[model samples]
Each structure stands twice: as C-alpha cells, then as structure tokens.
Target: MLLSSFVRKGLLFFLLTCLSIHISKAQFLLNDSISYQPKKLTTLGISAGAVYGVSMFALNEAWYKENKREEFHFFNDAAEWKQVDKAGHFYTAFYLSALSAQSINQCGVKAKKSALLGSLAGFVLISSIEIFDGYSEAYGASVSDLIANAGGSVFYWWQQNHWQELRLQPKFSFHRTPFAPLRPAVLGENIPTEILKDYNGQTYWLSADMDKFMRFPKWLNLAVGYGAHSMLYARDATNTANGYDPYRQYYLSVDFDLTAIETDSKFVRGLIKALSVIKLPAPALEMSKKGVKFHPLYF
Candidate 1:
C-alpha cells in the first residue's frame, strides 16, 4: 500500500514540476537567440531545489512521519509485484530524467551537459525517497528499486548521447481492472488513485521511433508493452491462495507521437511533450499465460 503511495506521489510531483517549469519559463526555453544564460540557469537551479525540498517534506509528513521510525535498513522486494513496481520505477525515472534534461536545455545549457546533469538529478530525486523508506518501520529501502532508478537515468543519458534523440521512448498506459475492486485498499478506491496503485491495470511500454530507423511515418511508432494481471497481492503465492493466479502480460501495439504534430505554439508543443508519456489507445495484441487476445482499441 505504501509502495503504491510512494509511486503515485513521486510521479505526480515530477509531472507537476515539469509542467510548471515549462510554462513559467517559456521565454527562456523558446528563445534560441540566447545560448547560455547564467540568470536562467541560476533561476532554474533554485526553483528545482525549492521544489525538491518541499516535495520531500510533504512526503515525509504524509507517508512516513505517522509511522514508527526505525534504524536505516535495506529491503529485498525484488520478488514482489512480479517486478511490475520495478518497471514503474524505471519508467518514472526515465521520464524524470528526460524532463529534467529538457528543462535544463531550455535554460541555455548545452545538450550534453544538460543530459548528464539531468540524469544525475533524476536519480537523486527518485532515490531520495528510499531514505524515507529506510527509516520507516513499515518499509525498508529497496536495493532493487535503487537499481531500477539508476537504470532509468542511465537509459535516458545513453539515448541522448548516442542518438541525440530518444529513438526508443518509455511510455505508460492504464485502465480500470476488475482486480482493483477486489483489493481496493491495496489498489485504490477511486479512478485517479487507482491508476497509480493498480499494477494489474498499468502497462509500461517501449515505443520505438520507427521513422528514425527505417522508412516509416514519423508520427507513427511501434511499441512493445509489459503488464501484469490478477495481482491482488504482491506475491504470486498469496494471490493464488486467494483464488487469483497472477501472470505477466506482454503486448505489441502502435502508438502516436504527438511531438510529430506540427504546431507553431510553444504551449502546444510543451503540452504534447508532457502528454507524450501516455500511450494512446490503438490496436494491440496481448500474449499471456492464460491465452492470446486482441484488442481493437486498448488504452
């Protein structure tokens, strides 16, 4: 339950920060005439620091402070959630790194430097939460989580340095699942929170920029996705004992690249970039232990 809360809060903070930063600093980001503005860099740094501080404080108050404190410790949760939570960590970190790099670039930083700094920033921001878990009696810091976080940041840096663009982008999608209603406390009670807590409903995707590699439409992407089903409990054994057999779900689908849309408005472009994290509904093929299925329109 707390793990879900952690994922939800961290994702929300990163997304909100990205939107606010881009909107508020439009002039800095949109202006190409200036290549290295010290003022802009400083302002961005201060703003990011402030946001980080406030977010950490809020997380502590909301999730950890109420629980009993314990000596800092490590936890082994690699077996939990069929590693879906780990995938969530990787997805979140990837976006956080991408957003940070984009934000820094807007402040006139060079792309290479921005990518490195942004990757570091992304790792730091996500891993900081582990400190909270380490001290909480209810949970311990997870090494697997830290590894996933690092993988996300490194993946962003690797793509930016090698391709100068994200040829393969990580994306996410979710839908209300019957499993959630079976475990409302662990999954969620409402639509919004359910999207965060319900691993059974969430799908993490790797959308390939087909045009970058071959003769394909720039607006179209071929994607592979990962998800889990019937995961009312973190462990497969517990879920099976409760009459739910947890299993992995894999998908092949097509995705739309909003950034490919030609728009003169900076706001529109930023909106597209921000919203691009979500995988739009399209035809998909699902393969799982239960059977193979097809969806004409899958979210």
Candidate 2:
C-alpha cells in the first residue's frame, strides 16, 4: 500500500535533470554561446517517454504484482494520515511539473509549450500510478490522489505562466521514529524501509517565500507542514487494540530557500537547487490532538 519510494525516485530523477539543465545553461550563458536544436528536443522527449515506460513496467512487476488482484474500483483515502499522503502526492506533482517544465525549456522548447507539456506529463505520471493501485487488492485508485495531483500540477503551471517563478515550494522532511519498531511488518523491517513506509516519520510541507508578498529576506520562508504519529494500522481501532493512539501533527516553521542564496558558481547553484527540495531544520510550533508543543529543531 505504500508507494512513496516510487514517487520519490521519480521526483528525484526530475530534480536532477532540472539541476543539470540549469548548470549547463548557466555555462552556456557565461560563454555567450547558446543554441537550441529541434533534434535535441525530440531526443529528450523520446528519452523521457522511454524512462516513464520502463519505470511503470518495473514498478508494476516489482511492487504491484506482489499484491492480490482486485476489481477495478475507486477508493476514498482523503482522510488517511490526516491527508499526509495527499500532501505528498501534491508535493510530487508540483515539483515534477516544475522540473519537467524547466527541463523542456532548456531543450529550446517555447515557454508556453514546455509549461503545458510539463504540467500534463506530471499529472499523467502520478495519475498512472493510480491505475496500478486500482488493480491491486491492497489499494485502489483514489480520487483524492488525483485531485491532489491536479492541484499540484495546476499550481506549478499557473505560477510559471503568471509569476514566472516559484514563490511557494512544496518540500519534504523526515525524522527517524521509534514507532516503526512497534510494527515492523506494517511499518518496515529496517530503518531505510521504515523511512519510506512509516507515515509517522514523514512530513510534507509548503514553504512560501514571504518576500513575494512583503518586504522580507528572499531566502527566508514561512512553512506549514503536516505529519502523523502512532499509525501502525489504517484503522484507529486496530491501532488502539495494539495500545497505540493515532494523532495528526501540524507544524508552523521557518525554512530557507537554498536556491535564493546568491551564487555565481553554476555547480553551487545546481547543488542549491537540488537541496531546495528539503525542508531545512528550524524551530517549529506543533499543534496536534495532544495540544501545542514547541521544538527547538524540527526537520
């Protein structure tokens, strides 16, 4: 039922591609030499398609096939983990759309063309995964997931088309938790595995650049985050029977925009761009069913 790893890898690949494009473009601009070839654009499109096809096939065989079959159907999982998975879906869609658009733009595609195609690509990539889940007995196609995916892609497209920049970015962060050990079979058998499967340890955030709206530092951001805890089972009753109390966690924190740091080195810029996907450590105020608490440092 946990498919974060697949989506994470897809996002990582797109981020890397975007970083590479930025670095290469920076170098070209520095040299006062730049050119766009239709052949290169065509090749990039073909390669992207091949990658998507191969990834889908591999994921279907390695993960989805392990689950039992089910009648094609839709599921309502909007309330799962207080919608943490939904946030993750949105995060994935937003970043993938932005990165895809940047990658296409680098290939000499027109801004409008690249933005439209990239947004479509991002929406399709995330939505296609639902088809796999729809056939698996362990999970079903979720309309909530599709809605989140659309929200993310549309956010990116609209921002790029109007503002021409990302003033608000979706980010993710995680911290190891002891709760995973309580249910290894369901959570994970190892730390690496648990980090991906355990919703209790994962947090999804939206970091907004305050400078976009007011006089503020460009590198500083106000972030709102969502996470969960004590969710070893899908049902609260099951978790309660296991002596666990499930609760949703909400956070308000300060974040940094690594990409906003002034830098002339292309490599540094690329590295910053890649690192920007992560929510930086900072003090946070958390509100949950247990009430409010403060963290000196929250990931």
Candidate 1, lDDT over the whole model: 0.81
lDDT, residue 34, candidate 1: 41
Backbone clashes in model 1, listed as residue pairs = none
Error of 2 at 35 (Å): 5.9
Cα RMSD, model 1? 2.7
C-alpha lDDT values of all predictions: 0.81, 0.75
TM-score versus the correct structure, for each prediction = 0.92, 0.86
Off by over 4 Å in 2: 3-36, 65-71
Off by over 4 Å in 1: 1-20, 23-34
Candidate 1 lDDT over residue span 116-217, tens digit each = 888898888788888888888888899999999999999999988887778888989999998778778788888977888888899999999899899999
User: Which candidate gets the maximum lDDT versus the true structure?
Assistant: 1
Task: Tell me the lDDT of model 2 at 156.
Answer: 86
